[model samples]
Target: MGMPASPAHDTVDPGEGLMKKQIRTTLILTLDDATMSSFVPLLQKGVQVKAQLGRSMKHLLCEQYGVNPEYLTERIQTIFLDGKVVDNVETTTVKGGAIIALSAAMPGLAGATLRTGGLLAAFRDGLTHEEDLEAVDSHELGMVTVKLFNLLVRELGPVLLEKGVWVTREDAESLVKRWADTPLRAIDHVEMDGLKVSLEELAGLDWSGDSEYLLLRAVG
Candidate 1:
């Protein structure tokens, strides 16, 4: 909000007067079993992934994101778009800045009610997502917030972490710091844009934005 109304801010830092402006940091980590287990928490907390908005959840996952239909039908048994429970993924469109939460079948009555097209779905009609006919129907690039729960976190989270997710540098730093206090596994390597970097460097890099989004990727 404080930058010039020009293209410079998008790709330049006049103050530093450098060709390579540090707008965002891309951090990649080589992790082992234990290190990855620790990463599951951040995945559950939610991370942003860039995708085509104004599309159905089914199209977003099955086509755009290339998720297997059978896996989508079986493993990912529950769906939530922007906090409301979803019954028909094919009709409920994901708007810009939408939050999508996925999970394996939850246990008990509440879980049964929340499952997509579950038999008890009618019980929660008040919470079910309904298409917004008023909203525009054009595809555009934007970020979607995704949260994984229970088995989904462990099962699906790694793919997302490896693919990379948008996160605030502060939050990413805090995650690294937390991992420091109670070490689960050794960090195999650290990188920024494919170049090796120290963990400290990754933490202190000038990742800039009002909210300051940085790409965090983990491979195990």
Candidate 2:
């Protein structure tokens, strides 16, 4: 699958891109409730998950990930597949290299208009996501980006972290800064692969090269 690696170079953006064909570098951390709160906001930036390319957003969440349909409908108020706003989840298929962003209702008219099948969908016109008419259906394994915002960060971020998600090099650098403010020693636990690792060691990591992922798992 074609995935564009995030910014390890001058060219890429902080979020919304595919990870390069990767390194299985995983760092699992267990933290106290207070410390874990620090990581929840990262979901708004975006995290990577492996998925079948042709599934619809409804199946991707409800069927593949076992998210409650009612919760998805009631709690998730705005949806973006890649960067476009979505008015329909059932018909719009997520492709390889796609990013899916979820949020509770945003404030003001932007929320009313951007919400899925909301009363103001007509106002969005061509801005809404549409299914590809000639696209081939594929069961291909690929990485997909999922970003959670507002309340969904607390509601859904942990679920993705528990399963493990890929973070960019930029996220790693930000993590170092966060850890500096709040020491890694304060974290409940941490492991790289299966071995315990200190936040200092993680902070000391040579982030200079192209091994652009830090597969982070949260166990609390």
Candidate 3:
């Protein structure tokens, strides 16, 4: 008689591979308490579509939910499985898979913490506006700024200076001058050296101390 099938063997499902292959994304949503209630289901759907997740999110939140994508995206950080490990790379992302963490960072206290953390360099680059800042919480917002600044300084700081992104004290001064006008949104480029500026712009953006940091999405 054939040997008894192992318990692990019988329980193994073919879909397990497919499920593992499935894009795992973690979304860090930054919204008011009222808005989070609406996002839960939408987030469930986002993980379903995988590649179309971002598009789906944009449609539901931006179009249907009547929320600003930038405002929401800024507060969210998706951590997914990737390769290797490095101290500088606090966040990991894998293609087709994303893990999300949500938090609110409006301004005030968070901004102060961010400035103290040295993330203010980017905001010293440009300015955005007031209404934009009101949408997020301080602590949540500050962490993103810190991450972005660290990434830029680590990866692109040399190149930006080499390419004249900024060199002289005049450039820094000019950016500081512009800060009085508004708060700027920082951009994180995954493929292009990971230089992010939005965090800095939003550094002085909000002053509200209500928010949380989504540290880890999911680990497999």
| Candidate 1 lDDT tens digits, 69-107 | 888899899999888888888888988889999999999
Instruction: Candidate 2: list runs displaced more than 4 Å.
Output: 1-24, 183-186, 208-210
- Give the C-alpha miss distance for residue 158 in model 1, angstroms: 1.2
**Residue-by-residue lDDT tens digits, candidate 3, 1-220:** 0111112111222322322231122111121223223223223222211122222323422443234555434532221112111111112212233332222333564443333113442453332111222222211101111111222222222221111111122222233234334343221111101111222332232222222211111100
Ranking under lDDT, best-scoring first?
1, 2, 3
| Model 3 score (lDDT) | 0.24
Q: Roughly what TM-score does model 1 have, to 2 decimal places?
A: 0.81
The list of candidate 1 runs beyond 4 A from truth reads 1-23, 134-137, 181-185, 200-211
Error of 3 at 33 (Å): 11
lDDT tens digits, residue span 43-141, model 2: 888889888778788988788766789998998999998778887888888888898999998999988999988999889968788778765558787
lDDT per model, in order?
0.75, 0.73, 0.24
Ranking by TM-score: 2, 1, 3
1 or 3, which is superior by TM-score?
Answer: 1
